[model samples]
Each structure stands twice: as structure tokens, then as C-alpha cells.
Target: MDHLAFDDFPDGLIVAGPDGRVTYVNERVRKLARAEGDEMIGMPLAEAMPFDDLNGHTWMECVRPYDGLNTRSAILEQSWYSPRGSEYLITASLKRDRPGGRVQQVVIGIRSARVRNRHDRERSDLVATVAHELRSPLTGIKGFTSTLLTKWDRFTDEQRQFMLETVDAEADRLTRLIIDLLDAARIDSGRLTLKRGPVRLDELTERVLRSISAAGSEPSWRMDIGAVQTVWGDEDRLVQVFTNLAENAMRHGHGLRRVEVVEAEREGVHGVRVRMCDRGPGIPPEARQRVFSRFWRSGPGAGSGLGMYIVGGIVTQHGGLVDIDDAAGGGAQIDVWLPVNEPEALRDGDDRGSVIGSGTTRG
Candidate 1:
């Protein structure tokens, strides 16, 4: 491999000789470690740099070469601090190489954990504020409405009916908002739980279609249920995933002529792959990576922007991967790849009654 190509690698790369001296540091490493101007080559690995891992270990300790070539690789978590003293956690992998019988090289790849941590913190704060603001009013409305129903016999029929309707509408709004909050919280904390079981995916799709249809939307929907019959996941969270995708299409599929949800199975490492596609104006290439990020909205005042975030989180919690790509006919397609086998049992005890919503996913 050309040495210059290492500079373009997305992750930071550092190549050190067997003597524990730096031979080459990639552009990414230079930028991240703030080592500019003079080449890092020829400097002792430990003496030339000052960096600490997330566990407060020295960079040298974290990146020490292992005994075997290509067989021993380890992940190191490091912390990088900003000028203002905010810290970021980074995870890097160190790989050992021995080539030409005379050279031993160690390559390091670095990724910033701080960016993800900061985004997570901001999302949590936002969800908390929204939930707190909405909870009080919802509680009062529900409480007063319950009181009225208790004394319904004293009120005229029309008065009672009106009160009931008001209560129902408020309750519905509160329920929807609360669900959104819960989802936001679950996603932010990386604690979203999945109850994996054999699921009839087509049945789930049809059920979601019927539910969406009942809501009185005119958008044309086409679904292709291929030979795939079963998936392993929490049925309810899977429903939430599809429902959020459909809701996103309804909200953003404005300019498109039709929206379609297709289901099919493709051979995957762990199992089969299930996908969902939409006909909304295709997401721009630049924004595709961040589409699943929390509170990421494309256009001005477009949405709360947590729909796809929740979808990604729920799918991920199930040990699955989700992605956005261009639709065949012009739109954005969201595909989710789930393992057929159940993932490792969740660490948190099985407690299924928790509700999911915008800012939080539980009580």
C-alpha cells in the first residue's frame, strides 16, 4: 500500500516501528493530536506526544504492539479535550504488521466518542424540557376530566358528552407527545430494549397499513411482501419503527406521487434483511449520514426530527443496522438489517410495560 494513501484514511492512523518510535502519522492523526509542521517521523512514540485514553492511560500503553501479526488487535479509548476543557472520548484500534521480514509496524485508527457524547447530552436535555413542560398540563386536564366523569350523573347528557370529548382529545395529544418523549430518552441513553421473537413481518406491515389508512390520508401506498415470513424482534418496537417511517413519509413525502413500503429477504451474515422504502424527495447525499441523528431536521421548521432517530435506535437495540439510500424511483429509502437469531439477552431485566414517546421511553 502507498504510504501517502494512509493520509486519506478517514480514521487517524499512526505507524510505529518495532522499536516503539513513530515512523509515520497520517493526516487525520496529525490534525486530531494537534501535531503539525514537523514530521512526527523519527520521534519516540511516548516522548513526542501527550495523549491520554478515556481510562487515563497513556497513549503508549494503549497502543503497545501485541505478540502476533494480524492476529492481535485491540481497541483503545482515549479522551481529547477542547480549548475550553470539554473532554471527548475516542476509540481507536491498534493493528500489528510485519512486512519484508525486517519491519514491524503498528497502525492505529481513531474515532471521536466526544461528538456522540455531546449530541447525546444535548438530546437528553431537550427531551427533558419538553416532557416537563407538557406533563403538568396533561396531568391537570386528565385529572379534571376524571373528576367530571365521576360526577357525570349530575350533569346534563350534552354537557357530559362535551366534557368527555375534550378529555379524549387532550388525552390523545398527551399520549402521542409522551410517546415521542419516551422514544427520545430511550434512544439518547442507549437503553432502548428489544424483545426478540419470531415475528410475521407481513402481518406487522398490514397492521400498520390499516392503522395509517384509518387515520384518513390520501397518499398512495404500495407494499411488496416477498417470501420472507419471520423476523426476530420486539413486535411492538418493530411496529413503532414502521409507523415512524410511514409517518415521516406522510409528513415529508409531499412532492412525490406515491409512497411504497417493500419487504424482502436477502442473504445476510447473521440472517435475512428487511427493508422499507419511501417516495419522498430523496435525502441529499450530504445529509444522509446524519439523517438518523437525534433532532436533525433538513429544512427549516421541518419536524421535531426524532422520528428517524427513534427508528434507528429501536432497530439498533435489536442488534440490527438501519440505513438511508436513494429509492429506485426517486425518494429516500430506509433499510434495516436484522439478525434472524436473537441477540444476546438484554442486561436490563425484562420489563415490558414501559411506554415510548418523544423525550423518554419509560416511566
Candidate 2:
């Protein structure tokens, strides 16, 4: 409604009159098309900023914006090449004063292809990671089952139990991988739901510690909890959040040392902050932001690298945040903030908690 609103828009925009001449554009369009001020004005829209596909068809020639079907009201976004060879995505809206009437104006939107390109690369990475992660477990499960069936009588009871246990563990690995993938999909689609209730942060960490230690030898760990308050979150998801963090500590931690949960205020929101500190090599300042990305790993490590990604997603879903920092003395310290109050949208029974930012999820 306001032309000025488009002044600072992230993407470029252009408007054309019924005659197909450039009538208006935002500041973004000038830099996007490399045009000087008012230079693009009055020229035919296509002539002013020509873009073409691989087949050499100009955008105007392909869309035939002024000559298309009267009922056609818009053009779907598609890839195009600028005259300078940079990639761009273009879409346009066709407006008519009356139903089935002649087109009055064409409003076009364009943005650099870098963002979409990055997303495509990330999706490709996800596919490759999922395929590789799935193959190892599937191979183990298949081999174990095949051997058991082919040599049913040759193995002793203890050997049989070990083989079966291996298969079981592989199956569990597969299940966890699938669940992580599902959670990732939900987060990306903004469909992640949180069943919120009061949750004790201190008890949650203790439970996570027990689970991790039960899996193997206990690491050198000490937990100090201050006067922390209960947080509003899904107990199961919160458990997942902490479990992932604690497990990370045990893996790369060389050995976990100090664990702390304390009450604090950030941006006026009172919440509980849980820090899982480890004695291993701490994350570098430059890499701190990347640890939470999908499939990110410190090095060649076990487990699907989706743990921290899912951690951030779940925390964001609960209107909280997560962060990685240098720990006391040495090693890494991961901080998770959980707000003590129910997210406004959660209180209204809507699952969209992305409106919440910093200090209760991850800063």
C-alpha cells in the first residue's frame, strides 16, 4: 500500500504500465540492475532491464506479460540470467481494473539467486547425509539377519545373543535417524508443535546425565544448579534438547567437567540457562554459529550430525535459544535458555513460537 515500504525491501521491484513501459521502481531495483537514478524510467520494461533464460528467450518474450491470456493474473517465480550473467529469480503480478479486462499494470519482483542457491545446496547436503547415514545401519542389519538365518544352528546361545543385540542397536540407530529427519522437516516447514507445561531444568539435566552415563562409563562431570525456576516447554522435547547437548559434551568433551543451571534475565525475560561445559577443544569464535547447522560436526564423529541442528530447532520452537561459547579455563560451553513463562502463541494454543527471540532459546 505504501511505495516507501518497498524502499528498504530486500528484493528488487519494478512496475510497468499497460504500454509495458517502466513506470516505477524501488531503490533496490537500481542496484540490482546496475542502473543509475531515474535511468530506467520511461523505457520499455523488458528493454530497460533485460533478462533471459538458457534458451535466450527474454523474460518479456517468455511471459508475454501484456499479451498473455486475459485471465492470467500472475507469473510463477523462475530462474533467469541477467545481462551481466548473474542469476536472479523473477515473478510478476498482473493487475486488471475489472474481471477479464485488459491488464492495467504489471508488478514485478526480483531477488538475487544466492539465497535460493544456498537452500538448494543445503537440501542436496541433507539428501547425501541421510543416504550415507542410513546405509551403514541398513548394511549391518541386513548382514546380521542374513547370517543368523543362513547359519541358525552353527552359533552358540551367547553368540546368537550378541548378533541379535547388534541388529537391535542398528535398528535403534535407524529409528533415531528417521526421527531426527522428521523433526528437521517439521522445523524447516514451521510445523513443529510443542506441548508445553512447567518443566524443571535441574531435574532435566540430571536425567540427561543418567541416560548418557548409563550408555557407558561416567565422564568427569560436576553440576551446580542455582535458584533456577521451572520453564514452560514440552518435557519430552526439552529432554531431547538436553540429551543432545550432554551427549555432545561426552563425545568431543575429552571429558565433561562443570555443568551449571541458573536463573537469569535476558532482554527483560526471566528464564533458566543451562550450560554444559566440556574440557575438550572449545569452539572457535568464527565457527560458533555453524555448529548448529544441519549435519555439522567438529570432525569425523559418530552419530548423525543432526543433534545440534534439532536442538536449535526445538529450542526455537519452544520460544527459547541456544548458543556455543568458550568455557571457563578451556573447552566449549553450550548455553540453552528456557523461558519460565509460556510463549504467548503457545498460551493461545498456537504452535508458532518463532516470534520469540534471544535469551530463552539461543542467543
Candidate 3:
């Protein structure tokens, strides 16, 4: 944990004394430069590291101290390319001793830019998805509302009722989409909290199914309420989990006909297993593992792509298991297993981490 232990740091680190002589180079830096550790210790930093920007500016300029003490200076980012075209981002900073005192030391940190660049692309993809998803519901609501308001007397009672109903449905969709976005942010920032207690899974399923039915999701549904017992969890969160899965089934089941939920015993595990199966095109074998990924979509549709991911997070927080399978009638089957005796929530020292984790496919 000391300064010298930078050797174990993931980022490359190097230190130069007041005279700009190389005082230390951690193992990470030595490995990155493909040079001996001791060989880099005594030489001038310029001769030892010799890092540079692609624009031809030497890293020596980047590490140079400004005209103040205790006022650290830094180079935000400098790009370097290896002989084989590998890229790195080197950030150098100067540490000062006291007000107007000499520069105490210069430190350089290095990290690969490949991962950062990939994340940038993923962020752009998320932005595009959000835009398209939000636009769909907004467009429907606007069109229907404007027509009804401007031409109220022109339509028959049935037609007006249909228009009003469509508007209401679109509004509801917009509200849910916004809530999903908020949930995603909360989950990512580790701010999601759960109120835990004993919850009846059978009753919760019936309530969620009633809501789905009221939404007019066109799918026949059945539930086998076994002699399952209560599980300790956040009742609202559990409701959200099944609601999400059921909605997902209604959406992806292009040919979706029947959706079923069953509570049954799982061998070798002291818990109840609830399976939600749909009769649709069925998730592709290879894609089953990735359906819970955030902002991931298997096809074109109006969805924020955060439902399944949120479902996974809530279940994980409750110390439960979730998996996918091929349903009996050739569709996706999602299984959730919750222990009758709920396990303690996970924590990190004093901070209680969020119940949800990253929805991104990669974690």
C-alpha cells in the first residue's frame, strides 16, 4: 500500500527526482518498456523512458513542473504507439513540495487506450438505442392526442375511444421507459435499495399477471401454484422481476401464443424454482446467455433493453439464481431459484452496495 508498492499497480508508474533523474520505475513500467528495472533507475528520465506524443512532443515536456509548489501539474492524456501498433495513454504529473518550493518528483501513469475506446463506442450505441426507443412511444402519443384534440367531433364514439385508449397506452409505455432509464442509473451508481420481508411468490405472480393482462398483452397465460413457501425478499422488487420477464415474453414472442409459470422443486437445492416459459420463436441457443445484458437487443423493437438486466440484478441481490433454457413448447424458459431462508445481503465494509449490478453484457 506504500508508494513503492506501485510495482503491483495495474497502471505503469515512474518517478523522477528534483533534478529530473529517474529515481524509480515500477515493475509495470519496466515490463511495458521491455527494459530492465535497475537499468532505468539512474538515467535521465528523457533517456530512460523517452515517451512521446504521436504529434512529436516528448513526454519530458509533459512531466515538467509548473511555477508553483504543492500545486500539482498534469498532462491529461498523451498517446503512444508501440512497434506493433499497440496504443497507450500516458498521463504525467508533477508533485511539488511547498509553496514556491522545487518540484519534489514527477510521476507518469500509463494505461491501454483500447478498452477506453471500446467503451466509448458502446456509450454511443446506448445513446442511439435510447433515442430510438423513446421516439417510438412519443410519436404514437403525439399523433393520437393531436388528432383527438383538433378533430374531436369528426370521429364516431368507438373511433374516439380507440384513439384515446391508444394515447393512454403510449403514455404508459413512455412512463415505464423513463422509469427503466432511472432504474438503470440507480443500479449503476449503486444507489438502489430494497425493503426486505417475507413475500409469497405465488401471490406476487398472480398480481403481475393481472397487470400484464390489463395492459392487453395478447398472450394466454397459466400458472401452477405449487405448495411453495414464502421467501424473504423485497416484495416490490420481486414483482418487478416477474413483470419484466412476462413483458419480455410478450414482446419477443412474435409468434408467442401461451406463457406459463410453474413453481416446482429443484433437486439438490433447498429452494423453490419458478419457471417462466413462452411459446414463441424461442431464444437462440447461443443468445440465451446474453439476454440479460443491458442495452442489448436480439431484434428491432421499442424497448430500453434494461428489463432483463434489472431482473437479474434484483435476484442476485436477494441471493438467488437465474438461468435460461429451452421451453417445453420450443420457446425461451427463464428459471429463478430463491432460497426459502433468504441469505444476507452483500456488503463492502461500511458501504451497502446497490442490490443491482451492471446490466452491460460484459459486466
Candidate closest to the true structure, highest TM-score:
2
**Can you write out model 1's per-residue Cα lDDT over 1-363, one digit (the tens) per residue?**
477878788766666677868878888778866778556888886754456544566655655454434554555555654343445554444544443233355565555666788888986987675766577558768776877868867888888777778778878767776787788887777767766676765567668767887788753655554444245679998899888877777678652233323333345344434455566677888888787876677764355567788888888787777777888888777777765553344223362222223221110
* Root-mean-square deviation (CA) per prediction: 13.8, 7.4, 8.5
Tell me the number of clashing residue pairs for each predicted model: 16, 8, 1
- Can you rank all candidates by TM-score, best first? 2, 3, 1
Single out the weakest 10-residue window by summed lDDT for candidate 2: 354-363
List ranges where model 2 is wrong by over 4 Å.
Answer: 1-46, 95-98, 101-107, 150-158, 225-232, 261-273, 316-323, 337-363
* Residue pairs in collision within model 2: 320-360, 320-361, 321-360, 321-361, 321-362, 322-361, 322-362, 337-360
Summarize candidate 3's per-residue lDDT along 1-363 as a digit string, tens digits: 156768788888878888878888888878877887488887787776665666666656655553433455666776776544578888777776765567877787878888988998989988988898899999999899889899999999999999989989999989998898888877788787889886777667778877887777644665555555567789999999988888787778642333333334556655656777777778787987687788877686636778988888888877788888788868878889887664454222333212212221110
Tell me the tens digit of each residue's lDDT in model 2 across 20-130: 899888999988767888888898887865899977899988899888688989999999998889999999999998988989999999999999899999889888889
TM-score of 1: 0.51
Q: Which one wins on lDDT?
A: 2
lDDT (0-100) at residue 29 of candidate 1? Answer: 72
What C-alpha lDDT values do all the predictions have? Answer: 0.64, 0.84, 0.73
Q: Write out the backbone clash pairs for model 3.
A: 294-359
